[model samples]
Target chain A: MSTAIALHAPIEAASRAARSAPAADAARADAMEATLRALVDAVPTATLLFDADQQVRYANPAARVLARLCAPDKADRPLAVVGDWHPELLNSGALHLCSMHGSWSGEVILGVGRGQHKILLLHLSRVGADLFGMTVRDITQDSMRESELHARNAELEVAYAKLQGAQEQVMQSEKLASIGQLAAGVAHEINNPIGYVNSNLSTLQRYISQLFSAIQSYEAALAGGAGATEAESIRRKLDLDFLVGDVPQLLSESREGIDRVCKIVRDLKDFARKERSEDWIKADIHRGLDSTLNIIWNELKYKAQIVKTFGELPPVECLPSELNQVFMNVLMNAGQAIRDQGIITVTTSVAGERVRVDIGDDGEGIPPDVLPRVFDPFFTTKPVGSGTGLGLAISYGIVSKHHGTIEVSSTPGQGTLLRIELPIAQPR
Target chain B: MYRILLVDDEPNILSALRRCLASIDVGELDGEALKVEAFTSPEQALERSEEQDFDLVVSDYRMPGMDGVEFLSAMMELQPAVPRMICSGYADRDAIIAAVNEVQLARFIGKPWVDEELAAAVVALLRPGSARARAPKALRAQAASARITRVEQDDDGAIVLRSDDPA
Candidate 1:
């Protein structure tokens, strides 16, 4: 603002001098012209003035340098026509547009010399009737920098997309690694029932064959007219009464074993199912918890007893398998915290529009210092190879994705409790 | 009577073991009929063991309250001369070593044990002055080979073999 006022000070002085005396007007005009010429000549922008006949009236020092570079052959001669300095500008019709519209501005390429060109920004304006003013600036380096920046941005976007893809793949591979770890406990769970059922089946086969042999002996006695006492002796010898009573018991036990095995298989199938796009379903939380418990029961059964105090719950809209993974992680941690016989209690309740699940374990509790960092990725208190440490971190992510919260409270040497609260219905 | 104590967390396992021992007679057991008492809880079995002496004790390795090794270690205090056996589907090497070195466990019986092998192990443990060798491997090789062929047909069996906890 101050610079504009200072530039107008000379012009104002000239105008005021003209009013004071007519005798000094010619001397003041020449002084004003010299001051204006020096100001225009000092600026880097090329400045040109033109008369109504389309002939160059004056060129600033910067404009003369540009004319010399544009047309070296005509450098010695006075620049009278616009085409001699820049044929592109003369062909652009900017002068005609400025005469009609009062002003025009554009960017153009000016061929300097020797097959090279410079990008130029041009501003043309009509000063008064039959007079025109124009300014030009070279912007070749600035435009090159802008294009280079654009290319770099595009490359960064592609790299960012690939990084996101790799992150998703890592999450999936971690899930698979956890499944491999659980396979040992699951195999133990299944093998127990299989063990008992196989043993019972073998015993039952022997008992049946014995009963069949007793029948054959009785048939022979009846067909050959043997004494009644002989058949009775044979029945007692075969322990027919014991076989009759125990066969049904064995059959029932075997049936229960097979049922338990089938349930384990189904729970495993549910646990290991691949995530799908349309995997969201309204599911019973209790059922998912029960199945997850069944899968990890082998790991927990020896050290802890599970106590479930489940209240009435409405169906929760969720990804069932992912939530199952969360439960498995928390429950497994609860089981591992115990050094001996302990109690793991899982309680659920609904308060307003949210459902709350609290898993508490009476075990060796977490230390106060380590409690806060439990959810950090790759943080572990367990021995190496026993845990990947992604369990709680992944659970935190899953719960957050459901727009829910998970918190833990622990008293050293007493127990630890983990509480998860989730909205019953997801927001659309 | 030759009193045998059986401990397993699963009721079905106890019942199956009882059936496998049902045919033992006085002649086979050196003039005494085999009397089997089964308990699902190791603590309860230990309480019972305190009340009466047992000729032999066979227990599952994994159980609530006390594992088979601990239970047998306590049983050794009650009846120092009695032999103890551990039966389990899980094959934790450290637990096995502890059972052998600390408890002086007489036998390690794998689950889905052949009925004849179980009966033989029990009889051998009970017999007077019998050389306390490991459970006899009479039908083990044949049975194991047969089971391996069927492992793929049974998904759990395949997993049991593939798992790091190998028997």
Candidate 2:
């Protein structure tokens, strides 16, 4: 009877222990599920899980808020309840446009919801057979800033272009006005000789007629064997030797005067010719320098000595006259810069598809601050009446028009170099 | 006796030229023997040249109504054999090209000219059969053709002709 009671006790105790072990396993599983729910609720991003049929099997606390804002009944309901809210995501499996949830289409915006705002970057990916995971983030401030930055950049570009155009116009007008003023001086200088030559020629013609008549009379008197008294009177009154010698000299002087006047007139005409655009030819830049030197020779020759180092440059296609103006401006400036005997060096060479010309002056160098503003229109360091300050500015414009570049470099008390680079080929 | 046509827009220059010419004589050539018809206006010179003829046409390149090239071209049309001489203090590449191409000039004298060079240029131009009077018609035609072709090519290409900036 003791053995029987012991065997029953052991069996009953073993059965109780086995039952408690299953209950502990079930309790551990329930705690793990609760921990998972807490993690999803604490997550900042909206996350949702769908079953094979796209029904909302699970939605985190944040996802619930998103669903309520997008489609209030979609939390525990079928995903089809919110299908109209994101029809694209349903059809294409995933959609990335920000405005998918808002009135503004195709724009990135934060989707606002109950007690939370999500960037709501909608992304859908298939997890298994028909199950999917949707994720949303928040990026509200970044998108707005990017758009504003782009607009600001565009405005800056427009402002820069306007500034460049205004600078160019002012430079061009200054050049034209200077040329007009110089033209008047050139005209006046040429007219002085022309006036005198016209008057001298008329006087000379009258002298010749009188001399011829006198010669004829004297010859007739000598041929007719006039009386001694008549011959004596003719010799005394006429002073035949003086009349014959001095009259030819006077006539010759008159002829020379007329020649001088002709030359002055011709030069004036050449200087003032109307500008023409019919001829666009390939010209040697050296020729332009030479011509400019000739035009401004008077201004330079007395104060400066020019040194030329010409390279074997190819011909450049351009309007020769306009280029001549550029050279004239630079050369004149070089001459004016010198206070005493100084060297003006003009060097040319072929650089790539362009020709580079360096007009350097060994005069007082431009100050560092002034160097940067040399090409600014109407900015002159010279006295008021001496410079219009358009020389360098106009040169800059002309170079730009030719699809060229002008650069300046200077060292105080040393000198300045004006570099002009012009393409050999014409601007297409 | 050589007849010289002196054209200048300035009356002062005309008077000075008259005085200077009166002072010098080459050999037995009397200053009075040289007939000079001075025109302060280019139009007047052109009209006068058409009515008669001149041994030489001395003209200024830049004038109010017409330039030296145009004036010379007109003069050459009326009298092809007459020699044209251009003198200018403002001798630039354009003036040289115009003198060479448009005027088919006899000589280019830059100012302020020396007395000897001035006399020699006048004498040479006046010399019988000394001047080469042919103009390059082919070059002018080629220039025109090239311009047309350039315009056509620009049209065919996608080059935007931006409007001139009003700034």
Candidate 3:
């Protein structure tokens, strides 16, 4: 309020002095107007004033510069009309708003020439009775910076999506590489059943032909009224009794062989099926273990005997296929740990709300120095080119993803025990 | 009579071998009949080998306690003159090299052996002046004295061969 009173005292004094000497007052008024024009002209904002007839009364230096760029034809002709340079102001009705409210301010994008454009902040106000003043501030550079920021943000979103796709691809390739490592063992397992089954079929065919020859001989003996002695000789020579007794056994054994091959294939499919969405469902842990064992049985059969001590288990919420992969990796390691015959004991039990699976091998155990690094990727005790070294590491990752913990305990030259603990239900 | 020893871990394979050998006529073996003594375990087969002599021995390459090469190597120690062969479903290169170098294998017949080829291979092994035929007559007589008592089935449904030798 004191500053307002100080400003009012100057104006009141000037007016009082003007009333005393009209000629001197006119000279002073002209000097004051010149000072105001110099101040407005120095500002970066383009300033303009209009008279009651809506004609340009004053144009500051900035305003004149704008006129030169925007309307070169009217550059020296004087800004006779406000609409000539700022047509948007008339179209936006901001001038009508200013007449009613005494002031208006907004941002406007104005086309200059040759399809070029500039952003301007326009402020219009009534300076005196029937007189108006306006200011325009160029703000095109500020808007350009904001749009560049938005474009950069969109690029970042695309990059993030690509990274997610790459991560999933890595997971898939790792699974396939693990299978390729086990392909030899699986092939051997299937070959065994197929070999016997194929042999069995050939033997069956020979035996059937022999039986058929015996039947033909008997028919001839009966039709020609030959003595029964000839028929007995034919039976003994053809070994009909042996064929009758062994045919059923051969068929059953061949069927069993085919069934085993089918089971191995089914188990492999169960273990290797891709979970595209990584969907979690309530699944039986025993089934996963059993199927995994079936798939890797060839790797273990020659080296170790598997012993199972399964306890009652509730349906645990988990990814069945990924968990099976973990089982296969651990079991394969257990098999490789044994140089000769040994025992691989698999035990599962529930303690409180956690389900525990323990896979123990009575094989050449890990030494103290190598025990801690077992879960590290590319760590292998086997000779190079025989092991991928990712078995245990991948298992660790899978178990951790299930919100579980895998712990290993070992004694040098005794054995290694891998124990996994998982919650019965996943936390929401 | 020609005594042939067949060993494999899978009982189905043993049965298939037996059936296949049964189809070979006595005429195919120089008028001599074949008596196959098949075992699922190499250790038991080795124990049986100690009591009696076999004309020819065919064993699967992979087994639980002992592989074919190891069993044949041990067999060579007991009976140096007996002819040994390996019949395996998986022909592992290392095992084949070991069989050739260590056991002096008579033949390496793959599993799912063609009836004619396997029979022909066996006939060639048991021909006159072959390893089995070149054995001393006294050893053959001694093998004839040991009698097979009875076939027993174990808990796992494997056939167990029992033999008795008169003192």
Candidate 4:
């Protein structure tokens, strides 16, 4: 009997221990809930918890402020109750992005009271089996900055276009002005010779007509029973024999002079023909150099001796007139650099797909520091009136347009060398 | 005698023309002797032209004050019957057009003029049948209309006409 009572007492003790353990577990759960609530309320950013149906279950102070901003009256209501809130948050099994707030997974917006527009970033995360936690932050300044950057980029593009247009206009005007100057010089030089040649021819024609009439008179007199002595006397008086012999020679000389003048005029016409728009063509570099030399011959002939070293070069595709301008500028500069009796050498060769041209002058070379900025617009070593400072700049632009390059090497006392490399064919 | 006035800017040209004209022997021919007077300046030539009626006038295209066309036009207004010719080295299309339209030039002689060609051109101008023909009033009006159309076509075609002055 004592053994049975001992066993029953142990069973009763086990039951009481079991009942006390459940009460301890319930107290622990309550303490955990209070700690979670305190943590949520203390956070800086807006934090909220929602049930599976998207109803707001708990909101910290920060979360209450955000809720009022996003949906004032719907702070404790289901998310769907807010008119502006995205319904996709409730429908989408996974988190959905809010485009208005620029957030990957939440419904965030400016508060109704703050009538001014603002930006907000929000994130929604699943917490438990039937709960979601959302965090929100304001980001109005960031969006505004992005918009301002876009506007600045557009303005910069417009300014760049205007700068490019102005540059092109200046280049074109410089080219035209140079051509006009050349044309004036050429016309003046050509007109002087033409004036005398015309007068000489006109006078020679009259003399010829008179001589023919005189010759016919002498023949008639000889036929009309005039004696040999009388005829001889008449011939000597009229200087008929001298006229007969010299008139034909004079005519021949006049004809030769006219032919020479005609040739020069024709050459002038051909050289000064109006150029078409810039277009690439297969051009012989040597021929182009020769033409440029002819055009600028008057300027260089007295100052320099030109030497040519032409190799078997392939034709290059380029704008012929533009290339001619470059040649003229370089050649003229070379001539001007010489004090007196200097040598200008032009050499050409072909390597692979490139045609290389070298123009070297035995004149004072460019200073080392100035060489670097030679292609800069309005940079000139020459006197102000003598140069517009656009020659090298224009040449550089022309070379670049042709998909070519120009380089210079110079020693102050020795000379300067300008090297140009142009592609034999245009790149596709 | 057909009196001709030859004007040039250069003294050498005037002297050469005088020598060549003085050497002519046209005594036996029924045609009158060609009398030539040379002047070194267009201004002097114009002065001489006002003093005497010249049968024909030849002038250089380029001069100091007035161009050949302008000088010739002035001469034409003074003596409408006188034939005018332009001898020039810079005889481009624009100059030629101006010569034809402005002065009604009788002939254009390119510089370093051949002796026979010059004589022929002068003879052609002096011929009785070659007297300046007064175009009908209607034809003159048509010419004006044609010039306008020509300019319009040139503008539409985007053709850049050469400048009037060769210089």
Q: What's each prediction's TM-score?
A: 0.72, 0.41, 0.72, 0.50
How close to the true structure is residue B42 of candidate 4, measured as C-alpha lDDT?
82
Question: RMSD in angstroms, all models?
Answer: 8.3, 20.9, 11.3, 15.1
Per-model CA lDDT versus the true structure: 0.78, 0.61, 0.76, 0.66
Candidate 2 error regions (>4 Å): A1-45, A51-55, A60-121, A126-130, A138-140, A177-283, A294-311, A316-326, A338-379, A384-428, B1-167
Summarize candidate 2's per-residue lDDT along B72-146 as a digit string, tens digits: 898889988777776655545545554655666665555454433455445434542221121134532332232
lDDT of candidate 3 over A210-250, digit per residue (tens): 77788888998999998879988998888788778888888
Q: Is candidate 1 or candidate 2 better by lDDT?
A: 1
- The digit string of per-residue lDDT tens for model 4 on A1-428 reads 11110112222334455567787765665565557556656787866555555566555567556545555556654432212243322344334332223234533445344476557776777655555666767667777898898999899999999988887677666666555546644554555555455565665665567667667777888789777887687677666776676566555655655664575565444444445545677878887788777666645654678899999987788777778778878887887778767899999998778999999998998998999999998998887765789989999998998889999999987899999999899898
- Model 4 has a DockQ score of 0.17
- lDDT score of residue B93 within candidate 1: 56
Worst 10 residues of 3 chain A by lDDT: A1-10
| Model 1: per-residue Cα lDDT over A155-261, one tens digit each | 99999989877756666666776777777667666777888898888888899799889989999999999998999899899988888999898899899989988
How big is the positional error of residue B51 in model 4, measured in Å on the Cα after superposition?
41
lDDT of 1 by residue, B1-167 (tens): 88999999899999898988885545666677888999998889989988999888899887777878889889988888777778887655556666765676666777767777776556655663331233345444332332323433443332222221112
Off by over 4 Å in 3: A1-169, B128-167
Q: Report the alpha-carbon TM-score of model 2 versus the true structure.
A: 0.41
Query: For candidate 4, what is the TM-score?
Result: 0.50
Separately for all candidates shown, the number of backbone clashes (residues 3 or more apart, or on different chains) is: 0, 53, 0, 2
Instruction: Report the poorest 10 consecutive residues by lDDT, candidate 4 chain A.
Output: A1-10
Best by DockQ: 1
Q: List the residue pairs that clash in candidate 3.
A: none
Winning model by lDDT? 1
